[model samples]
Target: MRTIAVTRYVTPLREGGSLPAIAEGDDGFLYVLKFRGAGQGTKALIAELIGGMIAKLLGLKVPELVYATIDEAFGRTEPDEEIQDLLKASVGLNIGVHYLSGSITYDPNVIQPDPQTASRIVWMDAFLTNVDRTCRNTNMLMWYKELWVIDHGACLYFHHSWDDWEAQSLKPFAAIKDHVLLPFAKELNAADQWAREKIDKSVLDAIVELIPDDWLSAESKLSFDEQRTVYKTFLWNRFTHSSIFLNQAIDARKALI
Candidate 1:
C-alpha cells in the first residue's frame, strides 16, 4: 500500500462514533482519514484494510486504501478540543481511503443492482461477519454509476474477543438478514462458487501482512507473530467453512421473502 502525508484536515464527517475526516494528502488527492485514535482504535483500521482487500479480491469495488502519516505538529493549530485530542493521539500512522468526490450515499430504494452483484455483496459481508451494511446504514456509495463499498471497520467481530476465535470462525452469521442487499441477493449459491474460484488462503496471507505491527502491538496482549498467526488461522478456518454462513444467508433470505 502507498503511504502519504496528510497535508490538511478538511472537515469532520460526524457520522458514527469514529470521527473520520476528509483530508488532503501530499499527493494532491483527497482521502477520508480513519484516525488511529478513534473510539474503536487501530483494530478498526485493521478491519478496514483486510476487509477492503478481500472485497477487492472478490471483484467488488472498494476505494484505494493507503497508510496515512500525520506530522506531530500538524494538529497544533486545531481549534476544537475533541478533534485536537483525536489528532494528537493519531499523530503516528493511520488508515486513509481515497475519497470519491461528489459521490452520494447508496439509496437502496432508488438504485437496484442485478441479482448476481447483490448476492456477491451479501456473501462477502457474511463471510467477513460484518455487522454494519444494514438497510438503515448501508456503507455503500454510488460513484459515477458504480457501487463502491467503504467503512468495513466493523467486520470480523470475532477479533474483539479472541476467547474462541477458531469456533467463531465456523459460526453462522445471523446478521445477514439485516444486510441492505439481501433482498436482491437472490444468487448467493453462485456467489459461493465465485468465492471458491476467486479467493484462497494465500490471498488472506497477503492481506494480513498489510497490517502494521505498530497497530497490533499497541494494545494487543498477543505478540506480533502470535497476532498474525491468529488472524491467518481464523480467516482460513472461516474460508474453508464458508458453507456454514452461506446456508445461514440462504435461510435468512428465504425468511425475508
Candidate 2:
C-alpha cells in the first residue's frame, strides 16, 4: 500500500531466522522491515504480503504492510557486519510491517482466545498452509488485548517448487495439528464455511496484485502475468479444497480435548 523511506536503522530483531529489523520510516513511524536481499529472498516477502492481506480480509488483526525504500548509502554506517551485508543486499524496495509498540508475544498458556476467534485463526493458517505457528514459536502478538498474527514468511511453501504447485495446493495441511490455537479451535467447520464465502477469486486477485513486479522478476523465469496466475491458482485451489485441512484441524482439536 503506502511507500515509506527507511530513515534510520534502529536495531535487528534477532528472534527469527530472517533477522527483520525495527527501523524508523520517513512517515515518522516505526516498522519491522523485511529485507528483499535476505537469504530467504523475495519469496518470503511475497508470503508475508499475501498471508497478511488474507488474514486482514478474514477479520484477523495484522499490521499494515508498506513498501519501504532503503538507500545503499545507509549500509555504510551500520556497525554490525551481518546487518551491513543485509542492508547492502537490500538496497531497493523492501517490505515493512508497521511496528506495534508495547505489544507482548502471545502465550497460549496465559492468554486464551474464544473458540470462534481461535478457530478463525486456525482456519486462516490452514488455508495459507502456514507451518510456523506452533506452540514453540507462535509468531503472534497480543496488542491492546487483541490477538495479532505475524511472520508469515514460512507459508506458501509450494512457491519454492512451482512445478508441483497444483498437487501441493490440494494436499492437506498436516502441520496444522501443531498450531498453538488448535486446541481452542472448536469452530473449524463454521470457519471454513465463512472463509469460502469471503475469499473468492476476486479477493485472491486483489491480494496477489499487491506484490511488486520487481520481486517476481528478480530471479524467476516466469513472466509477471504468469507469476500472478500461479499465485491465484494456488490460493483458489487451497480455499476450495479446505475441507481436507478443516477435518484435520477438527481431529486435532478432538485429540487435544
Q: Please list the Cα RMSD from the true structure of every candidate, rounded to 1 decimal place.
A: 0.9, 1.1
* C-alpha positional error of residue 131 in candidate 1 after TM-score superposition, expressed in Å: 0.4
Worst 10-residue lDDT window for candidate 1 reads 213-222
lDDT of 1 by residue, 9-105 (tens): 9999998978999999999999999999999888899999999998899889899999999999988899999999999999888999999999999
TM-score of 1: 0.98
Q: For residues 84-139, what per-residue lDDT tens digits would candidate 2 score against the true structure?
A: 99999999989999999999999999999998889999999988899999999999
Q: With candidate 2 superimposed using the best TM-score fit, by how many Å does residue 184's alpha carbon deviate from the native?
A: 0.3
- Report how far off residue 223 is in candidate 2 (Å): 1.2
In model 2, the Cα lDDT at residue 199 comes to 82
lDDT score for residue 84 of model 2: 95
Number of clashes found in candidate 2: 0
Global local distance difference test of model 1: 0.92
Q: Which regions of candidate 1 deviate over 4 angstroms?
A: none
